[model samples]
Target chain A: MATSTPTPDTPAGPTPTEARHRRIGELFWSSDPNELRPWEERFTLSATLLLLLLLLGSPATVPTTLLAVTGLVARDLLHRTWFWMAVAATFPLGLLRMSWLAWDNHHFLLLYWIVAIAITRLAAEPDEQLRRSARLLLGLTFLFATLWKLGTPDFRSGEFFAYLTVSDPRIANVLVALGLQDGTVVPTLAAELRQLEPGADAALPIAPGVWRVAELLAWATIAVEGAIAALYLAPLTSRWRWLRDAALVAFVLVTYPVAPVSGFGWLLVSMGLMATSLTGRRRTTLYLGAFLAIAVFTERNAVRNAIEQVLSLLPGVG
Target chain B: MGAIGRFTGLVAPLALVLVAVLQVWGVTQHDLSQWKGGGFGMFSTVDANANRVLDVRLVTEEGAFPLTPAELVGVAPQGTGRFVSGTLTLPTDDRLDRIAELAERSAWYLDEQGAATSDPSSASPQLEVQAVEVTVYRPVPDRADQRLRFEPIAHRRLESPA
Candidate 1:
C-alpha cells in the first residue's frame, strides 16, 4: 500500500497561508503602532489643539517644556537616541524648581532619578548598555532593600507594632493581638524586632507556636530577595527570572497603593519600573498601563495643579 | 621656567574658573547665597493683589529697595521693583548702629517692622531721633544689583524744647 506524505501539521480547518503571511506585519515592540492609524486621529488633533492653546496662553516655561518633552519623546520614538538622552538629561535641570523639593535629605535623595537618566544616556547603544544599566539599577534597588530590612527587626514585622497605637485599632490589634496577622506578619523579622524590643508594642499577642510561621515566611523573603539580588547580577540564571519579575509586580502592588501621590519619589519609581520593560526580560505592560490609568484618573488633579502652576508663572496668563 | 611650565601657569587659573562654573551648572541651582550673615536684604515687592510685602531672601541679606547713599536723602527712590513707593530713611551716628543691628535680625521680622521710626511730620535732623526719610520707588528684581540715589531735602535739624 502506498502512503501519501501528510500535509504540514495544519489546524483543524483549512487556513489561508497567504492571508496569514500578509498579516504577520512589522512589529512595533515599543510604541503602539495603532497611534499612526488614521481612524484614531483625534489624539493627534487634540495634541495639536492643546499645543496651540499652550503656546498662546501660558508663559514661556510651561508651553516650552511641554512642547520640548512631547517633541523629544516623539523624535526619539523614531531613531533619536542621542537627542532623547540629551533632552532627558537636561529636562530636570530646566523643569525642576528649587522650591518644589522639601528641604532635607529627601531633596538630595530625589536627584537619583537624574543620575539614573544620566547613566542611561551615557550607556544607551545597541540596547546592551541600557540592559546593563537596568541590571545595575535592579541590583542596587534589591540589594539595598534586602540588606536594609534583613538585619533589622523592623523589616519582617511591617512596622505594624510601632503603628499599633494608632486611631485605627484593627491594625494595632493585628500588631498587638493576633500575633502579627499570619499574612500580614513575616515570621522572622517580626520575631527579631519583638526580641529586640521585648516590652515594646511589636509583640503580637498569640500562642508561641504560631510565632515560627512568621519567622519562616521572613526567612523566605530574605532568601528570595537575596536570590533576586544575585539573579540580577548572574545574568545567565534565567530560572529565577520568575521570582524577580513577581517581586517587581509585588513591589508595585505594595508601594503604589500606599505611597502618596503628592510624593515625586514614588511616582519616579513607578515611571522607572514601566520604562525598564523597554529593555527588561520581564514583559510588564499591564502593570504600567494600570499605573498610567491611575495617574490619568486619581492623580490627575495633582498633575493638573502642577501644569496650572507652571502656566500661571507666565507673564500674561491668569 | 620653560614653555610647558608657562603653559601650565596660564592654564591653571583658567581651568579653576572652568571647574567652578561647571560645579555651579552641574547641580540643582539655588541663586540664594546660603552663606549665613553674608547675603544682603531686600525690602519688599508688589504682589498681584497690589499689596506691598517684604521679599527677604534669607540667603542674600540685602534690602531689595534702593541702597545708594545718594538715594538716602529726600530724593525719590527708584529701581527696586516694589511697584510701590517706599520711604527710605538713612540713619546717622548712633542711629546708624541701631539700623545695622536691627537689619542683622531676620528679614521677615524687619519687614513687618520697617526702618523709619519717625513720620514725615516729625522734627528736623538735629533733634529728630529717627533716621533720614526719603521715598522708595521699587523693590529690586532678580535681574541684577541696583543702588538708589538720594538727595538732601533739608539742611536744618530738629529744634529742642523751649
Candidate 2:
C-alpha cells in the first residue's frame, strides 16, 4: 500500500481526541468482525447486550421501552453518551410508575450501572472511567449486602434461611433433595401457615435438621460474600487480582443455581467482566461462559435440576 | 472537561450514597422492608412480601368478615397485587386509602353461603359493606417454641361511600 506524504499544511498525525474517537469507533464498527478488540470495547458490547436482555425480559413503561427499542434498532447509538443518559433517566421513572417497592434489588443495580455507563462515556478517558466505576460499584454492592446481613438479627441468627427454606419452593427443593429437610414437611407447614389468623402466635413444627442446615448455609453465605467483598475492595496487586475474578465467578456459579436470581447473577457477571483485563483469552472466555451460563440457569434451571436428579438416583433419596 | 462532564462523573458515586441513605431511611422512618429499596440487601433478611400478611375485612351492619382471596380479586382485579405489595413495603396511609377505595367500589357482596357475587337478585342474603379495614402484619420468629408470630405493623379503616 502506498502511503500519502504529509504536506506542510497537514498535521503530523491524528490528534489525541481524534485517535480516542477512532479507537471507540473501531470497537463497535470493526472492518474485520473477527478482529480482537480491547477489553473496554468488549465490556461495552457485553454490557449493552445484557441491558437489552434485561429490558426485554422485564419491559418497563412505554417511554423507557420506546427509548430502549430505539437504541436497539440503531446499534450505532449504543456508543453515544446521550442515548444512555436518556435511557437512565427514564429507567427510575418506569420503576416509580410500577411502584418502587415492587422492584427487586437487581432492578436498582441495573439503573445504577446504566447511569455509570452514561457518566463514564462523558469522561476524557472513558475506558479507565468505566473500569473504575465498575470496580467500585461491584465492591460496594457486596459490602452493603454483607453489612446488612450482619446487622439483621434474623439473618445473623440463621432464622431467615430457616424460614426461607420452608417458604421458598426453589430453596426448599434443593434443601429437600440434599436431605436437609423432609420433603413432606414444607407442604405441611405451608398449609398450616395459610390457615393462620393475623396477629396469631403460632408455632409451626420444623425438622431439627433444617435449622442446622440453615445455620451452615448462613455462615457459608456470609463467608463467600465477605470474601468477595474484601477481594474486590482491596488494592489490586498483580498476584492477587486474579482472586477477584475467581471469587466473583465462583459466587455466580454456586449462588445462581440455588437462588434462581438470574438477573442479579447476570448483573454481577457483567460488572466482573467490566472490571477484568483482557490479558488472557481464557479470562475473556470464562466471563462469556459465565454470562451464558446464567441465562441457561434462569431459563432451564439446569444446574439445580441436574443436582436434584443426581441426588435422587442415590439409594433412599427422593 | 466541561462542567457537565465533571458533574456527570459524580453521578455513580452520588447514586450509591443516595441508595444507601434512602434504604436506611426507609427502614427507620418508614416501615419499608429491608429486602427492597435497592441497598443491595437481597437475601439478607426475611422481612419481605412473602412474610407480610394482609388482613383485609369488609364491615357491614351484620358485622366484620374477612375478605376471601376470591373477594379480593373480585373487588380489585388490577389493583389488588399492587395494593398488597405497596402496603407490605411501606404500609403508608396512601396505600391503605387506595385499598379502601377499591373495597368500596366492589360490586360483589357476600351471599348467604358466604360466597362472593355481584347479583343482587340472588335468593341468598347479601351482606352490604359499610366499611373496609386493612391490617398489615409481619412475621417474628420465636426461638423458644420454633414459632413464627405475626405482629400487626399497620392498620387502616375507612367507611364505605354512601
Residue A227, model 2, lDDT: 85
DockQ of each: 0.02, 0.56
Best by TM-score: 2
Cα RMSD, model 2: 7.4
Error of 2 at B122 (Å): 5.4
Regions of candidate 2 where Cα sits further than 4 Å from its true position: A1-37, A60-77, A89-97, A301-318, B2-10, B59-62, B104-110, B113-131, B159-162
Fnat, model 1, is 0.00
Q: Which regions of candidate 1 are displaced past 4 Å?
A: A1-64, A72-78, A94-96, A99-124, A151-161, A164-228, A261-284, A289-318, B1-162
List the pairs of residues colliding in candidate 2. none
Candidate whose lDDT is highest:
2
Q: Write the per-residue lDDT of candidate 1 for residues A73-98, one digit (tens) a residue.
A: 46323234454354345544532432
Question: Which 10-residue window of candidate 2 chain B scores lowest in summed lDDT?
Answer: B1-10
